[model samples]
Target: MKEIDCRGLPYLKIIREIKKYFNSIGEGEAIVIVNSELGRSNVLRYAAHKGYQLDEENEENRFLIKIEKRGCLEVEDEGEIFSILITREKLGEGDDDLGKILMNEYFEVLNEYDKLPKEILFLNSAVKLFHKDSMAMEEIRLLYKKGVNLLINDTSLEHYNLTDQITFGEITSMYDMVVAMKRAKKLIRL
Candidate 1:
C-alpha cells in the first residue's frame, strides 16, 4: 500500500490530492496520516461520498486513514468531473444589461442542480458579483453554502477596487486557481 504523509496540508488539499491519485491509479490501496480533526472528518466524508472503502485508526490528535479504492460514486455521465471559470461580470459579449441578467439567471439555474461543479473561480470583472448589491450575489452565496468552493482572484478583486466588498468566498491567488483548473477533469468557462 502506498503511504501518504498529509502533515501541514489543509483538508481541501488533502482531499484533492487523494482524489487525483485515485483517479490516476484507477484502483489502489493507500494510507494517509492526518493531524487535525477537520482533516480527519473531511477525509472520511470524501471517501464515503465517492464510495471508497475506508478504515481508520485513531491516535492522539492524529488519524491513520486506510483507503481502498473499490469504485467511484455513480455519476450520471461517466468519466467527467467539472470546474467552472468565470472571468466576466456578465455572461456573454452582447448587450451589457442583457448579459448581466443572463448571468443572474444562469447562477439561479445552477442552484437547482443536485450536484454542483467541484469549484468556481472568479477572475477579472467576475469578482464584482461577490460585492454588495450585486445581482448574482445571492445565488453564488447559495452555492458557497452548498459546499461549492467559491474562489475570487486576489489581483482581480484589488484591481476592480472590490477588495473590501466581498460577501462570500475566499480570496485566492492565480497560481492556486490555475492548479485547480489543470487538475480538474473538465473546466467550463463562462
Candidate 2:
C-alpha cells in the first residue's frame, strides 16, 4: 500500500497532497498519517466524499487512515445541491438583542430539518457565531455533526480577532467560497 505521511502539515496542505496522490492512481490502497485532529478529519471527509472505503487507527501521537480507492460509488440523487450564505451575526436587521435571539432560533429550527443544505458559508460578522462563547454554538455543532459543511471566512476571522477562538468549521478563502457558491444548485443568502 502507498503511504502518504502528512504529519505536521496544515489541513489544507494535507488535503491537497492526498488529492494529488489519489488522482495519480487508478485503483489502489493507501495509508495516510496525520498528527492533528483537523488534518485527520479533513482526510477522512475527503475520502468519504470521493466514495473511498476507509479504516482508521489512532496511535500514540498520530492517526493512521487506510483508504481503498476503487471506482467511485454511485450516490443517489438527493435533489438540488443548495448552500446558505450567512453574512451577519443575526437573521435580520433592527435590534441587536432581538436579532441575536432570532438567529439562535433560526439555527435551532434549521438543525431540526430532515434535509439540510449542502453547506453553510459564514462570512463577515457571521464568523463570530462559531466562536467558543457564541450563543448558537450548540446548534452550530449539531448542524456540523449532522454532515453540514461549515465554511468560515478566513479574513473575517482575522478581522474579528477570532482566528484562534473558532473551534469548528474550516477556515477557507474567498476564492474557495466563491467556488462553492458557484457549484451550488441553489443558494440562500442572509
Candidate 3:
C-alpha cells in the first residue's frame, strides 16, 4: 500500500472518488487530507464503530480503514495509513462568531450522518465547545454517548483554567495527538 496526501483538499470525497477513478487506473495508493486532529479522529472513530479490526495499541493514530475489504466500496486492494497531524483549532479562519456558527452547523451535519467521525478534539479556543454550559455542550454529550472518541488538550485545560469546568473527554498531550493523526484512514476539517 502507498500513501497519498490530499491535505487542504477534499480527502474523504477523494477516497470514494478514487474507488471510481481507479476503475480505469486499476490499482494504486492514495492519501486524503485531514488537517485537524479532530477531523482525523472522527474518521478513525467512524471506522471502529463499523467493526473494522484496528490495531489496539495503535488505535489512537493508525486507523485500519478497509474500503474494498469491508464490502462498503469495491476497490482492487486494501489500504494503510501512515499518519495524520492537526494543530489548528478551527477548520477555517474568519470571524470567531461566524466560525462558531459554522462549526456548529458542521457538527450537526456530522451528527446526522449514519457514521460519525472517529473522534472530536478540543484545543486552544476550540475547547470552548466543552466550556461550561456552552450551547453545543449537549451535542457533545450526545456524540460522546454515541461512541465518538473525544479528547481535550491538557495544556489548554490548564491555560484556560478549565480543569474544574471541562466535563467531557480525557486530557491528552501532543504525543497522543500525533498518534491519533497518524492512525486515521482519512482526515477531515471544518
Root-mean-square deviation (CA) per prediction: 13.8, 13.0, 14.5
- Look at candidate 1 and tell me the lDDT of residue 27: 80
Better of 1 and 2 by lDDT: 2
lDDT of 1 by residue, 16-51 (tens): 678667878978889989999888888887777677
> Clashes per prediction?
0, 0, 18
Instruction: Estimate, for each residue in 1-190, the C-alpha lDDT of model 3 and write its tens digit.
Output: 4343333444345334433433435344333334545545654554444333333212443333332223333222235322212234344687866766666655655555555667765667667677765566776678788888877778877887777776667789867866776677776543
Clashing pairs in model 2, backbone N/Cα/C closer than 3 A: none
The TM-score-based order of candidates, best leading, equals 1, 2, 3
Which of candidates 2 and 3 reaches a greater lDDT?
Answer: 2
lDDT of 2 by residue, 21-45 (tens): 8779888899999988888898888
Instruction: Report how far residue 103 has shifted in candidate 1, in Å.
Output: 0.2
Better of 1 and 3 by TM-score: 1
User: What is candidate 1's local distance difference test score?
Assistant: 0.85
Task: Give the poorly placed runs of model 1, Cα more than 4 Å off.
Answer: 1-75
Clashes of 2: 0
lDDT, candidates in the order shown: 0.85, 0.87, 0.55
